[model samples]
Target: MDLMAMIENAMTSPVIYLAILALATLDAFLPFLPSESVVIAAAVFAVSGIPSLPLIIVLAALGAFVGDHIGYLIGRLLRERRPGGRLIRAADRIAPHLHRRGGALIIAGRFVPGGRTAIVTASGATGYPLTRFTFFTAIAAVTWAGYSGLIGYLGGVAFESNSSLGLVVGLGLALSITALGELVRYVSRRRAAATGAG
Candidate 1:
């Protein structure tokens, strides 16, 4: 079937919660999955009373945190073995800025595609102190989960009110995600340039 029908079917499925948790985990590490869609679907399912809002939030947060930690460990291991690895080298350039403005970066990164993964990798590659990384990452995880969940919940409400509402809200969210990604890229490039110039 088409995308909307598939989503509607998934929303009613008994295994949707499991699928959502899995999606959240994969999305965190893979960086390419449409994770936002998964979370929104979970919220939509919540409207049907299959998955509770609190449960969705908890599962989403746990899955995201675990996935990020895994990514971080991978980055650390890779950097330890190959200090000059391309990814590590790029991460190294931003390590200092990450160190200085980690909290803000982590929070903002949550909204940008590929940013959460990049931040986790940079944290490990840069050897950021574990305690600090954990503290900030926890904050970011909570913020990200809550924000995404809220969007999904809102989407569900809109879908319930009117079919056109879903389309409008989904399109708006998509645009917001794209704009945020572009903004993050611009900021990163500017920071890199300034660091070079200085």
Candidate 2:
């Protein structure tokens, strides 16, 4: 059997769900985790009936929620130990904005590499309440996972007959979507800054 077929065979129920979940959780603590890619891959596999879309979403969301909490806890611990540190300073600066727009920011941050980890961590460092953080993060994680999974599913459908085309298009679209989000965030921040300066 070819590599993909072999992989699909090995992608038993536990392997598929557990692997995605682990990666998703790890990415929360380490922004460089590439959990999004894995989720996309899982979605791609789901296209062939190798896995289930709902299962992928479930595992991804679970990992994201749990991982973010760990990151928050770590930030809280560090905050207690590090007086006037960078995290604390950043938290102070963003705390007001986060307080006013925590849910929106969390949702947007999920698409921005490194942004979610930093923001979530900072929130904890600044004593952002666990209850509020969980509420916002839970929502963000679900939305982010669903969006990513859909992207992969669509890409897989497009490449159903052409693997290379599907991969190229899938990756391209994913990157494009992320870029768009970043652009919007950049412009919004700039506009807000400009208004503040006025």
Candidate 3:
């Protein structure tokens, strides 16, 4: 069988849920793993009813929640033991803004690939309130999971005859959204810099 067909068979197994959870968790800290794509693929298969869509969203959210907590703890440790660490230093520099808009930033960053890791780690390093962090992170995780899964589901519906094409469409949508977010952020930063200079 071809590679994709083999992968599709493997993903259809019962253990795919656990795989989804694991990948989502690792992607939070690792940032390089294609957890979003995996979720999208599973969701594309979900249209076929092999894996439940709601379960995929729930597991992905739970995994992201747990992984972010780990990142927070790691950042806290660095702040305590390595005050001069690069991440800690960076966190220190942005601590003021993080303190002011931590909730919105956390939620928005969760959608970006590496931005989530950086923001969560910085939040910890800066000792941002745990209560608020937990609340915002929960929101971020659930929203992210739902958004990713639904996008895939929609793609699958649009291309019901071709699951692979559905996966591509879902990924394209995700990348487009991320790019849009980056553009917005860039423009905001430029405006803020101009205001500061004025």
Candidate 4:
């Protein structure tokens, strides 16, 4: 069967929620998992009044939050293993800014493919504060889950006759959002560098 058919079949299973959770969790450490796509599919199904939207959001958010912590723990463990090094020093240089504007990074990363794992892993490796990281990541998790779901819901609703088109629109919008966020970050960094030089 095709992608939509497969998704529909998967939804029939009672443990689909568990699958979503597991995929989201693994996606935190392993960027290969298509958690975002699964989430969008689930949201699309929800729009068709098949599955519940809130459940998808909750599962996605919780999975994201816990996975981030797992990355943090991995970093903390690595920190314990090594002392001061060039890598640590470099991370330290960026730590303060990460702590200051970390929320934006976390939120933006959620939408970017392969970004969630990288951001959280880097944050942990650099020993960013657990409390602050948790606070910001939580917000990012909720926002990402909601925003992703909403995007899929809108697409599915708008293109009910052609799900393929809906999926394309949803994925396109997500990528566009990621691109815009990266652009903003790039501009902000350039402005900061210029100010520092001045």
Highest-lDDT candidate: 3
Candidate 1 Cα misplacement greater than 4 A, ranges: 1-3, 161-168, 177-181, 184-198
Scored by lDDT, model 2 comes in at 0.82
TM-score for each candidate, following the candidate numbering: 0.83, 0.89, 0.96, 0.84
Evaluation by TM-score, superior candidate among 1 and 3: 3
Q: Model-by-model lDDT, in order?
A: 0.76, 0.82, 0.90, 0.78
* Candidate 1 per-residue lDDT over residues 1-198, each given as its tens digit: 887777677766767667667777787578888666766666755665766777777777777777777777877997989998899999989999999998788767767778888988888889887788777777777777787777777776778665336645754785697697788789999999999999
Instruction: Give the alpha carbon lDDT tens digit for every residue of 1-198 in model 2.
Output: 897666556453568788889989988778887788878877876787768988999889989999889888888988899968887887888989888888788777878889888878877887888898899899988998898788878888988886446656766789998899888988999999999999
Segments in model 4 whose C-alpha atoms lie over 4 Å from true places: 84-90, 190-198
For candidate 1, report its TM-score: 0.83
**Over all chains combined, what TM-score does candidate 2 have?**
0.89
Tell me which residue pairs clash in candidate 2: none
| TM-score computed on alpha carbons, candidate 3 | 0.96
Descending-lDDT candidate ranking: 3, 2, 4, 1
- Candidates' RMSD to native: 3.2, 2.3, 1.1, 2.6
